[model samples]
Target chain A: MSAPLHDLTLAEASAAIARRRLSPVEYLDALRARFEALEPRLNTTILPLWEAARAEAQKAARRIARSGPRSPLDGLPVGLKDIIDLAGHPTTCHSRHLLGNVKAADAAVVARLRAAGAVFPAKLATHEFAIGGPAFDLPFPPARNPWNTAHHPGGSSSGSGSAVAAGILPAALGTDTGGSVRHPASHCGIVGMKATYGLVSRRGVFPLAFTLDHVGPLTRDVASNALLLGAMAGHDPQDPGSVVRRAENYRRHLRKGLKGLSIGFVRHFHETDQPATEEVAAALEAAARLMAREGAKVKPVTLPSLTDFAAVNRVILTSEAASIHGRWLREAPEGYSALTRKRLLPGLFVRAEDYVQAQRRRRELVAAVEAAFAGVDLLLTASSMDPACRIDDAEAVEATYSRQARTPFNVTGHPALTLMCGLSKAEGLPLSLQLVGRYFDEATIYRAAAAYERAAPWAALRPAL
Target chain B: MNEDEAAARAPGLGEAWRARAEEVAEAAAQARMMAQGFRAPADETAEPMPAFAVPAPARAVR
Candidate 1:
């Protein structure tokens, strides 16, 4: 109890709880206090259930005392993006459209976490239906970066990333279709993993783009991310997209170090395709060097252009999203923010041939990415082409939004993770690097991320609240 | 639905709102055209991803 309970990572807190050094109630109280002090500035939570969470934590404390711990997530406070279903609570998707839409059952992932003894303290904010950008016209204000309140914390999982980075919670679930999870992690200086497509069930989660959408975890560090992912991953027969493989112990390989690992550093991604800011490019180089020092063999590799992957991702996303919202657009267009309406309207114009072509090209793109891994165990690239821009600067936000390497993985359905590499000198904001592994090979991503985290001090850095 | 019908669906909005929606539609149209035009090298016979599969009958529980 020497350190504030809110400051402990999920792993550390779970360990303390198992040993009776800290009770779940005490842990939840600390996080509740942190939430009260920070929520005013961050606007992360849309439906906080702290009292209910505290009651659940008390039960968890008693259960653990009677019999060790259910899992590493036992009694840990994990938040959910508002689009995810939690029985008896409204799954609003941070839009006025869903303000009255209450859920009658838990999302598949939520049921898994609840079974693992995790306590839900709040449902976090997200971009409207996970497609719109941060808009002032939304029912709730967009979550701000904890590193600097003036800057954006990346979305559509804005609240998940901001809350974890600000020490309000150790972990939160975020969905990524076009880099929603990794975008926030990149800007917030936290760990976000979009595991291979369909590795986590999406049955009760609202879809942005059915084929491209993925549920993921955003956490303060790599180890905790692995633990949370382990708890969340499993086959769900009810979910059509769910993979039918047994979930592996993602943390099993965390300590394996980077020795004998061959990493393909996709330099063209941040260098030639979509040029990153100078500081971001330099930090990526430093991260590669750190990995090399850890005994990883780093080599340059190439894939299709950033535009190619991004185009395929967008065509499919917009087309599918358009189809889903066509009725809503025609019936209640006034309910949507201008930004969401603007983004969704484009999909209506896309031809059937265009969507089909994009899907066909997607196979080729996925194969190209797989071929890039021929001589490598993993791929390294930039998560965000630049550090986060100011939240209020719509021009800057629009300009830098598509300038990233993350959409490629979503297009290819690879397990990709982004974690803090360094802090930007000029703005004092976090800069991040991404590691990608073969499909369903998230363990290796965790291995390399943990190694880099141990060597670089960025993982220990916290935003001054 | 066609683009014209899609636009007409949002009737009775403010002039600025309609203008903004028009701009968005125009931009989106251009982007879609560009995406359609950029032909990445792929086999002519490559099938679209997420290819449909027939669901198997559920197995009887023991």
Candidate 2:
């Protein structure tokens, strides 16, 4: 039997397209059929660009046949989180207030994807304004986890996670602020990376928290994540947060393995600081052993406590969000979902002194991460406290919101990534392991994660949709 | 400040929005306290707060 088109990773499909074994049009057609069958149940896409995407695919097929692939991303179908503008498409952001908002120009990332000959087939769902969700009260429904439809897929890049995991798209762009991209990636059983802050331009992506927000990629595997990030990364003069740095081939060192490298196992972050389930803890311990077996010197290392990071992250996020939305809150108070209202309101009460103190603490946290990096090349920890819980359980969702070990990277402006490590013993969902790297060190992060993907038993498993 | 007082102090966030805004403020207050707890005193002459700066570009030979 032939391998299914939808099952091909971005790397797989791109190679096939380049070799003339697979046509871009054929690949997109297969994915479109899958999306049609599974989308209603998954609610992963808020806007489907069926005709436009088909035309683009056909165009790409012709180009590939005439010449060759444009880049590693050529002819691959990718989803854009609704918060990303796509030049004339609605950037709804899953909010009622922005239902009429349409893009005047493509977001920097979207334009880059187009230049790479990738097809944008849909606008994936996001938390309202990228901060207020899994909210049912929004204009669109929250995406369900494909592993089990009743479970949450994480958010606010909720749809990007589900779509990639469900094979509707091999890769998608997601924004991470306080773990939006990594959270969804963990729950959806995919690879997501929030590379060093300011590495990817945030000019066209909607803001959640200016300093905290990061544009990232969600892919079914580590190699594809690397390819997608490579395509979208470049400094933009328009984005003040963007940094001018030499571009990197993120996949250049994927096979370097873990030999002669120091991997820091942040056990206390999961074991004591936030306390994960037995299954999650076991999975992390096994991951450490697997890395050690792969010839990496895995050892315990400590940074600031998880509480310190979360406190600093929340204060900064809320204060910035409050400042951004204060006008809207006063003008259209009822337009927002109740949860978002609650989440953003706290920002209003943050005293100026508190915001300044958080900024100062943020500096210290950054210094701590830098210090930790002096001893270890990479840091490993639990992605979440446990497997995904029921999407409908409001209290459970609220409880788990701040229970992850991801916010510390955002606070400190380092690269962080999450990938499946094992299956949850209690809930049968994917348990994830997080890897953190020093600023602008995504190649090392990819190298280590690719090694884990090869050694870990979880990579071959897929959600039975 | 308490929620009620916070809402009242703001010009537009009045009675109907008071309770919700207050709840948000309370959450913010808790986070504030938490941030405060993580604070460690620095030296009397510690350098000024960190700020973002533009990197100086390389210059051409005269």
Candidate 3:
């Protein structure tokens, strides 16, 4: 017997829809049934657009019957993090302050996805304003890891990770500012990419930090992630950060093997910098060995300490986030969750000289990374220091925030992809590897990640939920 | 600035908000220290990093 519709990857479902073997409506129904059964426990979505999505799926089905698929994303049911605006729909950002925040127009990325004929079934949950999260006091409960529902799924793209992993949807939109996309992808065991800073437009998405925020995709597989990124990419004049680079066929290099590729293993980032768990350390070593065995040249490349990157990132992130939330934080300080308030309020204390200094440090760090990339095509590092822990553990959550090596790229504006590498022996939760490429070079990053995914056994495993 | 002095000197900040800012004081200080390392020898002549500027739209034919 064939696998269930919900079990199929986004690419598989898109092909099935195009072949007429599975109608868009049928696929939506399968996902709806799965969502109904699992959503309560996972809390992945804040607003489930059931009837509207069914209507759209029916429209897509008719279009497929009359013509062919509009794009690779056609008829694929996907979720958007609540931070993205959908015209005539509310984007609550999982905060009480923005509960009435409805958009008059779709976000640039959402508009592109709509043009591609992708079906939007829900707005996934997120950390309140995509910064502070896993808190009990929020407009919606934080998303739980499907691997072990009690454990954290990482954030601020919490729901995007959980929804894709739970198979409620094959793919979803996520925004990464300081490893939000990769963190959940790491903890949830999926593929997430923070495309080059300007590759995807941020217009209409709620901003946490304009200079640091990135819109990306979370998918169960690298191929699907590539497909989603291709659809979402392009320059938007409205988004100041959007670049004018020509659109790339992200899937063009997916099948290219790792032979002749050079990989830089950033051991010190995890070992001496933040110090990953033995399981994570072993996973990193195993991943490097697999790449070397696959004909890729793997070498250790050293950069500045993780503390330097984290310090620079936090300074810029906190300062900018404070400026954005200044009004609400000052007028209605009670509107934000305690954690969000705590995390964001610190920016208020940052001196102007300090913000400038952080920017200067950021430039130096970017130069250091570029220098490292000169000798290697990609840099590999741990997505998180350890596996997912119980969501209720406050101390663990605080430590995990500073434990990730994913934020360095956010500071450098380089493209990064995180994919499952192994499962922790103790918790059986996913451990992830992050691949960093030069700015606007996601094609190469995806090439390396796809090669790694092909050789790794982790992608074959899925949550029982 | 020390935590107490920074809080007391803060503009229009409430006691609770001041306490919250104090929580990340060490992090702010670390970032500041890193920034100092980026200073060029002739720092006064260096240009400050510019904020992101919106791109101008293409002009339509008259």
Candidate 4:
């Protein structure tokens, strides 16, 4: 049909490979060609695992030659965020530190993906240790937004966003501590989900904030994110934070329409707490109105002050991050970009009362999200408070890291997904909304996201880059 | 806890309270580790082993 490739979703690829209509080698070669063509413009990757990918694809072809496609993601190449360990590959979280830190063993999630027959082609770029970034002094240049290379791909999972947006990888592994994954996905016009805290294993993941870090998938669309999440969903005893959940096929409920689903709009977060740019605000309105018209109920509601939650998240995230990076901060302080080191240093000075008050406030917000869900099936907000910004604006970068719209959920540990709503006039960046689901009920979130994606096509438009 | 919950409780987590919790928490952690495959290793020097020290650099964050 289309070179057995050409922007086919993971679902389509899996079906074609199962029917023997497409070979994994052909898919990998096509993917590699597209990546090679786009890498210069996108600037989204640090390492491109060509030889390893070829070897993996040949093995997948043989396995399919013996046994028909085993999993929905069989033979698909997934880009992993560089911070996550991949055995034999250096997990250099875009920092000078850990320049040669290759894993002797695969992380629990990597092992699972290997079992699912997914090929990992490269370690995608991330903010320095998933905190300080978009600063060029680090080992790797910050990933450019695929939409406009001059624009910022919102960090800290900057590369994950750019690479997935450029079609270099359909599905990617991204960690969300403070919307590292969701912000970029929303910024880059892709599907990004931040699963509930403890829903996915973070054992081998380099620690940012031990309390807030959660790993999830960034994919081209809903179905592909589902496949990637399904492969990596279960608990591993190795990670103390991983909770035991019954293995549920994440994609099985994809077709469940949003007929009677209920969604609460955290309007105050946009309206007053920190008003979203007019374009972002308008897009959220359109997404909410569209979702409601499609069948799900949408109504305006308020949770904790977005500013209050942001403050709590700032204190706790930085405190824990400071704990994790304190040794590094003291040692290779210059090894860090100025933004991360300075931003993180405040954590060391934060009073224990602030951390505790934040956690105590967290309990309240968790109750608030729980209370909101009682009246609604999901909660919606602008994924990023605003759209992409110019990479050169240092104060804006500091303000951004200083005032992230994402930490509220990280505090409460709810599952949130970012879906592109429309284009924004502000900076001509992609505007999107965050669809947050009840704890452990990502199925409902996926169903709603897929329905919105189905009703309004975002996957059709690629970044002008 | 709310004020009511705090009032109901005997006392709250004060300075000594944190100290006491840290002690008990450390003991509980050791006990759990002993129960698991990992036995608590003997305590050793707790000096900070920083990876690299910035050479006379002033705070440069804006």
Candidate 5:
């Protein structure tokens, strides 16, 4: 049991610690030993809160020893996206801009996690600035994919994906403005969710596009994602956009299958709009078929072209992004990476009429999707145009980032999830399917995704490192 | 010339999609005007951007 304790997941290790089956000190020690060994090869974490982590772990053990009240995350250690602020630790955003800008207070998300008693092992790597990245010109090297260090582990949640998949942390806090969270989760073969636009607060997070940015989780399974999300989901009267949804036990419907469910597929998005590789297509089709066999009313449905989501997302994202960083761009233009500076430079060209028209169109677009969902419980597509690419292919998450996959949901402001569908038999890389739910209907979407996850055999296969 | 100081000084959606908010909102409004079926940009690639632009971010208030 001790031989490979280093590789056991947070979920697996927790039960042992909770029952006094494993010492928190020993578990953490083993984790640190492995973290040290893995760090040189993986290059995933930065500014590990080792001293703070040990102190927290010790406190948790004292509580478990003295009394029995334990927070769900009582003795767990978690990795956080570098963009989220951790008091006293530099919220670097993996860029030189914030190198010495040590946060004076934890971002709401980190504060909440610590309140739940989880250890902050470290701040993990991210694509520089979260919007355009995988850039190495910044303070840290981009995280390598654990499956194949030479391959791409998607960004801007690059480090979160690598850290979690490499078993360096139980779960991680990652932000998804575009497909950042889900893309990495898919490429790294983990579970990731971008909750409804305002379901979680973005306060204290470095802004990319205020409207589209979301703080979410990338975990090894739905259960762990649920635990982390539960602790972090709540109203922050501080964030103007955060909605007032009751905190949900995100894991409630996991055991339920797709009985009496309507799952629709958007095939053209996968096949034509941003054509997926053959293996990706097959993996998606197989998942759909399996759901159908399990009594889901699965059918192909259509929405506007993938091109529309791309255009709208771009205008809105860029326009908002430009506004947020304009001061920074104007003053410290040289501070940002060539990738971000270039990607954002285009926003400088958006006209006022264009911005307003995009918003009005957004209203119409949201209405269109609302109508589309009237006939289905959820919609599906390929998470990415292809499986993991070489991490070195390009620094811009936008390069191969297709208009087909996630942008539409971004336009409609709905909750979307991505799960590993199956391993590409040809390349041994993972393939994933996307599920978008009615705005705020993540529960049903999770039910459908969780049903498929259990019924299919994909979750059992880890990437060969 | 920036949004806060311009004609597009927004009232709703506040600071949220500022420039694009105005552009997309107006694009929908204009498409309505031109009879060019300017449905919102949902999931489609945008038409190459109109050769125009949003005003800059506001200058600091003295």
Candidate 6:
């Protein structure tokens, strides 16, 4: 209890709640106070569900007192990216287009979390429809990085990353199609996981791309990320993309050291393919060394070019996103922010032949990644090629946005988790490394991440917001 | 919508829209070139990844 209430990780808060040492109401009050102080600076929340969250907290406290907790997430607060549907709340998506888009049903993931007795405190900010970059023209101002308010928090899971990193929330959900979840996690110095495609149901979450969209969790640390993912993962028959796998105790393997594991370091990804900055490269190297020292057999592994994966990802994403927003583009082109319109507009020109080729190429890329996993238990690479650039600097944002190694996994449908590996000495921003696991092997990813997290100094380093 | 139809409707939207369309067109052209240019190891007979299946017949209510 030495730490501030808001500083408790999701796992810590859950433990405290179970022991009856921390009342859910008191924890919620502490977080609400933090939000009040920091929300003005961060712009992380689009809709604050303060009153409802208070009622939920009291209900959770009473339920725990009467019998026992429903789940580890029973009394914990989890923020939703605005694109996620919560019954009777508008899934605004930070665009003028859907200002009145209130739905009557919860998203599949939301329903699952509600069943787990998780409390929803706010609808977090995201880029328009999870495709656009940060923009000043959107209905809601983009979320700022808590590490340095002047720097960009990666998006389209901008607020999810910002809030969790800022310690305003212990955990939040962010949808990743082409690195939305991991991008923010990388920039905000937190843990974000994009489990294998179909591992988490995407129903009721607004789509960026039908084949590629994935819903993921963002938390301050690796174990909390795994815990959140445990509560969120399961099959929903209604969601065509949801895999029919049994739910997992994601944290079960956290204590398992890296002794018997073989890690494939995709050096070509951050070096030859899309060159990362010096600090990021050094951090990745240090992480690989640390893992090796921790008993993981780390070795170099190669896959297809980052360009090829990026092209395939972009082609499919733009094509599907364009199709979904086609009517809007035709009818109300003016409603979209200029950046969003520009980003979505490219899909219109993507020929059917091009899209088909992309998908065909995607199959090959997936196979390529799978083939690489033949010798290794996991793949290690850079999440973002550089630390976050300033949010207001459009040129820097544009230059650094695509300089990432994440889209490859989105294309390949592998489970990838990004966590802080080190900080950039020059800028004091967090530098991140990625751990990718085989399909449906998130527990192993968490194991390796937890191992590395324990050995590295990054987990204890917090943004001085 | 097809490229021609988009082009036909784009200009009338406004200058900003037109400019955005132009930027998109340029970028799309580059992406198309890159996608088309990259030769996959797979042969011409390779099928795209998405598989389509016929839906099951609905049961009649008793």
Best by DockQ: 2
Stretches off by above 4 angstroms in model 1 are: B1-24, B27-31, B51-62
Query: Each candidate's DockQ score against the native complex?
Result: 0.19, 0.21, 0.16, 0.02, 0.05, 0.18
Evaluated on chain B only, what is the TM-score of candidate 5? 0.27
DockQ of candidate 6 compared with the true complex: 0.18
Candidate 2 structure quality by residue, lDDT tens digits, B1-62: 77466544653565456546556456556655655655552532344234332222222111
lDDT of each: 0.86, 0.85, 0.85, 0.75, 0.74, 0.87
> What TM-score goes with each of the models?
0.94, 0.95, 0.93, 0.86, 0.86, 0.94
Report the first chain's TM-score for all candidates. Answer: 0.99, 0.99, 0.99, 0.97, 0.95, 0.99
lDDT of 5 by residue, A290-341 (tens): 9899889988898777766666667767778878777676556668887776
Cα deviation of A328, candidate 3, in Å: 1.3
Model 6 ranges with Cα > 4 A deviation:
B1-21, B27-34, B51-62
Q: Give the higher-DockQ candidate: 3 or 4.
A: 3
Better of 3 and 6 by lDDT: 6
lDDT of 6 by residue, A1-465 (tens): 789999999999999999989988999999999999999999999999978999999999999999989999898899999999999899999999999999999999999999999999999999988977699988899999999999999999999999999999999999998999999999999999998888788999999998989999999988899999998998889988777777889788999989989999999988988899988899899999999999999998999888889888888888889889987876688898888877787787677888888888888987788788778889999999989998988888876656999999888888899999988888899999999988788888999999999999889888997
Candidate 3 lDDT by residue in tens digits, A305-401: 8887887778788889888998787667779888887787667667887787677667777778878978888899988999998999989998887
What is the lDDT, from 0 to 100, of the residue A255 in candidate 4? 82
lDDT of 5: 0.74
Docking category of candidate 1: incorrect
Residue A460 lDDT (model 4)? 72
Q: Identify the candidate with maximal lDDT.
A: 6
- TM-score of predicted chain B, candidate 3: 0.35
Q: Which run of 10 residues does model 6 chain A get worst, by summed lDDT?
A: A341-350
